[model samples]
Target: MQFMILLDMTIVNVALPHIQESLGFTEAGLTWVVNGYVLMSGGLLLLGGRSADIFGRRKLLMIGVGLFAVSSVLAGAATSTGMMVAGRIGQGIAEAIAAPASLGLIALLFTDPGERTKALGAWGGITALAGTLGYVISGLLTDMASWRWIFYINIPIALLVLVLIPRMVTESKMVREKGAGLDVAGAITSTTGLFAIVYGLLQAVDHPWGSAAVVLPLGLGVALILAMLIIERRAKDPLIPLRFFANRTRSVINTASLFYMAAFISYTFMLTLFMQQVLEYSPLRTGLSWLPLGLGIGVGIGLGTAFIPKVGVKAVAAVGFAGAGVGLFLTSMIGVETTYLGGILPGMIVFGVFAGASMPAGTNAALHGVTEQDSGLASGVQTTALQVGSALGLAVLVTLALRDAMGEIQQGVDVDVAMTAGYGLALRVGAVLMVVGAVLIAALLERVDTKLRDPVAEMVQHTA
Candidate 1:
């Protein structure tokens, strides 16, 4: 289930062109195909997590899987832009409900410290593998069959999850106070605010900042976000407890995660374009090119796991971010004449390794002090930061890159050269952002014991 949800996040990158052709999507409109899933999922994740705590994790997981299967079929058969985007939105909502619940189940089931560490390592490994394989799988499916198969493939996975969840997992939830209720208003305000902001950014791809098309949504979005924050304060059982941010380690990690994911997501999107549009590589070749990155991530995770007990989460994460920043800088140096081995491989390897290493450290930091009752909430918050960052990064960075490309085209630059230049610019900015995150992590992330304990599971028991 985790693999399927995470797979959808990257699989669509390789199939963007095909989807555009089939659905008659404009360049800016194409982002909706990706954002619709991530934005909805990110925005509603808090509610979904809390809902799982209030309802039952197993029940929510089954519901989410069922919805996901239906959404996949909807996406597979779509023939119009609206339909495709709608289908993706449905998938995102389903993911919001399922992902944290699934993680919460793992936390619950693995009570022993040693068993918990192994379970989490295995879970994180699967997530990395799913993200890595998504591109290759999409390429093979899109080239051999059709882009629609990417969506259709989820049906079997969903069916299997639906069947197995009931039999294998027992139901569990947090024990809430008698008067507690779901925070529907908080969810609405947050989700819609995020949507408005993303919509405004997308409009900037073609319209100026001053234009009402851009300004209206941006203004509305900010206001709604503020309203949501205010509402969270007043709600009896807030979607996100404001005091949760009082935990400095969790707070810093989540803040840095936004920047980390923002850079990473935009990097992926822009690199895909660089590979296919500028280099004219076939989708299969482009997919194959990403293999090194996956391998690097695996290696990084292994090294990080081994190092965290010696060096601490702060050191591991800081090193990872710094190394990834350097990798992004190297990647930004690519040009029209550059070959994959000569240019792309080095950066991908460095970025993949460091990026992979940082993930476990961040996850540990975010969930470090959380009690079992808030396990789903903690996981949801971290995932929400990542998903929201993905949407925001892609929207902002991609818009800047396209805007620069358009400017170059006006100056009579060759089309391919202009595109390459724009991509380079975005990557450099992303690299800088990554470096900034590293600095912040080094400065702000609280220091903890360099012990080889399962922080989350043990801490949950300790706090409880």
Candidate 2:
């Protein structure tokens, strides 16, 4: 189930052009296909996580997957931009309900510290692998059949999950205080706030920075976010308990995740555009080209998992982010005439390896000390950070890139040159953001005892 959701994240990348052309979507409107899913999912994740604890993990997962299948059908059959965006938004809502519950189940099921660590590593690796495969599958589906097949592909996966979940997984929920209610208000405010901000950012592609169309939604989003904070403070059961931030490792990892994902998402978006639109690579070729990066990610995940017992997460994560940043910087050096083998593969491999290593380490740190009770909450926060980062990063970075491209075009730059130039600028900024995350990980993450096994074992025994 998690694989299906994560796969959706990247599968759309390879099919973006097809969807745009089929649906008569403008360049700016096309972003909504991606952002709509990410934005809603990210915004509602806190609520989704809490709901899993308050309701039931298995029940929520089943419901989410069922809805996801339905939403995919809507998206697959859509004939207009409005229907497609609506379907994607529905998919996001479904993912929000399902994703944290899936992770929460894994965290709770693997109680042993070493086992939990390995499980998390496996989870990260599988999902990362799925993200990579999404491109390949999407390419094949788009070229051989139709882009709509990408969404239709989820139906069988969802049906299988629905059929198997009841037999394989038991229901689980957190024990709550008497009279506690779901944080519906917090969920509404956060989701709407994020949507407004993303909408405002997308508007920048068409409207001036000072235009009311851009300013109003941005302002509304900010105000709503402020309201959300206040509401959470007063709510009987907040979606995101403020005290969750007290865990230094979790807090720091979550913070760094935002920056990490922001840079990474933008990097992928730009690279996809560069390959398909600028380099004229066929979807199949473009998807196959990402094979190296995917394999690198798999290798890096293994290395990260093995090294954590020796050096701890801080050092491993810092090095990973730093290396990934350098890779992005290198990739940004490409020009309009550059070939993939000579120009793109090196950076993709570098970025893939380091980025992959960082994922498991970050997950370990973020979920450290978490028990079954708050497993859903921790998972939700981690996922929320990444998704929100993805949405915001894509929104901001794409806007900046398009802005640059337009400026260059106005100055009489060649169309391809302007496009590549804009993409290059965005990728460099993404590199800087990655470096920033690395710095935060290095400085803010406290050094742990190298004997992680002994401490984790002891902690588990104490809890038991």
Candidate 3:
């Protein structure tokens, strides 16, 4: 269930052009198909994590999965653009509920250190694999069937999972202090603040930076976020514990993850468009083309998991970031005549390897030394970084692509030339962002392996 939800995010990218043509969407309008889901998912993640802590994790997972299934049906049957966007938003909400709860449940379920490490390794591996393979699956669905089928496919799988969840997964909930209830004020403030910021960023692609559509929402978002912070500080039971940021390693890793994902997200979204729209590859061929990249990521992640306990998280993450930068730089050099085997494939392989290796090490570092009390928040923070980064990345990249496409068209460039120029510029910018992320990680992360024998004990001692 976790893998499927995560995969769906990237899978839809391959069919973006098809969706645009069928729905009669403008470039900016089409972007919301992706951004709508991302914004809601990212914004609600912290709340979802807290909800699982207060309610029951298993129950929330079941509800989230069921909601996702229903939303997928709605998205597949969407006849109008608005309907599709609404369905996408619904899907995001479902994902937001499912993700953090799933992770928290895993932590609660696995008590032994060795068993937990193995379990986490499996989880990381599956996530990396799903991300890589989503392109292939999406491409095949788009080419062989209608783009709607990409969403339709999720329905049966979700149903199967729903049936199995109750039987297989044990029910568990956090032991909160007496009389604790959901933080309604915190939920509203945080969700609205995140939505405003993400919405503003998405609009910046089509609207001028100074336009009211862009500025007002962004300003409101910033203000709401400030209010949320003040509320959190004073609240008896805060949704997001601000103290989690006090740990230098955890704080730095979260920041770095956000920046890194921004680049990675843009690259995947734009690259899928380039292959299908600009390069004009068949869906089957496109799917097959991604195999090497997918396999590479699986291999890279396995190796990183094995090495982390030896060389340490900081060193592994640093190397992974550097490798990712090199891969992104290579991707930026691609041209209209670039061959898949020689040009695109090599870069994909390199990227897959670096990304695969980096995730485990980074996650380990971020969650290291966290106590039981802080585990859910730590999970929420990490996942939030990823989703928010992707949302921000896509918004920025789409905006840049639109600006370049418009400029080229105004300059009387041919349609093909204009489209290629926009995509090319977007890829180049993505590469630069990856390089910047690498620098941030290298400078900010301290070389420390805080995955001690008893993380809770360490945290308690540190507090004392």
Candidate 4:
């Protein structure tokens, strides 16, 4: 279930051109095809998480998956930009509901700490693999079949989840709220606030950063988030308990995850554009180029599963971030004449490996000390960070790229070369973001690991 949701997040990237051409979408409007789904999912995740805690996880999972399937059908049939955006919003809402419930259930199913760690590791690995597959599969489908099939593919997967979930998974008991009901006020405020901030930031690509058009929404967004904090503090049943932030480790981990994802997602998006738009690779060839990245991620996950239990989550995560930083830096060195093997492939493998290693470690840190009752909310928080990071990072980095490209275009440079320059700038910035994320982990996450023995590590290594 988790894998499916994450896959949907990026699978459409390779097919965006086809989607835009088919739907007659402007570039600005086209961005929404991706961000609309992300923002909605990120915005509503807190509410969905608590819903899973209050209602049954199994019921919510079924509802979410079913909605996703229906939404896929809608998207696959979409002929207009509005229709595509609407279908994507549906997918977002479904993901918001389903994702946290599934994460909470993982905690519920694995009562033993050792077993729980292994399950979390498996979850992280699978989610990473699925995300990697999305690019590959979407490219293949878009070239050989149609862009629509990228969405149609989700129907069977969602249906399979619906069928297997009831038989394979058991439901967790609802956490009774002490308040009058759901925190409707908090939910409204947080969702709107987050959406506004990301939306406002995206406007920087078009409007001046200092213009009222950008400042008003961004300022309003910050104000609304403050309002949400106040509401959560006063509410009898807060949507997201303020106490979740009390854990220094998890809070910092979640924050770092935001930066980590911002860099990583932007890198992926720009890579796709650089290859297809700049280098003129066919979609099938582009898909094949990503195989090395997929392999690297698989290898890194294997290493991380072994390392996290021994060296600790914080250490592994920090190391992974550093390696990713270097990898992205290498990518920024690409030129018009560079080959895939010489320029992009090595960096892809390097970053892919590190990203794989960080997945389980970061997840473990975010979930650390979360009780079964609040597990859903914690999972939602982590996932929200990821989605928001992707949206925000893509917005900022792409703007940087476009801003530069537009300058060159104004100077009468060829659009393709100008765009390549833009990609280079963004990739470099992404590299810096990775370094910042690494610094944050070192500065903050060191003590997050328990000094005491891990039973899982004991069983694996039989060591000190």
How many clashes in candidate 4?
0
Candidate 3 Cα deviation (angstroms), residue 29: 1.7
* Candidates by TM-score, descending order: 2, 1, 4, 3
Q: If scored against the real structure, what TM-score would every candidate get?
A: 0.95, 0.96, 0.93, 0.94
TM-score of model 1 vs. true structure: 0.95
Q: Write the per-residue lDDT of candidate 1 for residues 133-162, one digit (tens) a residue.
A: 988998899889999999999999899988
Which pairs of residues have clashing backbones in candidate 3? 205-399
User: Predicted candidate 1: what Cα RMSD to the true structure?
Assistant: 2.7
What 10-residue stretch in candidate 3 is worst by lDDT?
Answer: 448-457
Relative to the true structure, candidate 2 reaches a TM of: 0.96
- True-structure RMSD, every candidate: 2.7, 2.7, 2.5, 4.5
lDDT of 2: 0.89
lDDT tens digits, residue span 163-216, model 2: 999999999998778998888999999999999999999899889999999999
What's the count of clashing pairs in each model shown?
Answer: 0, 0, 1, 0
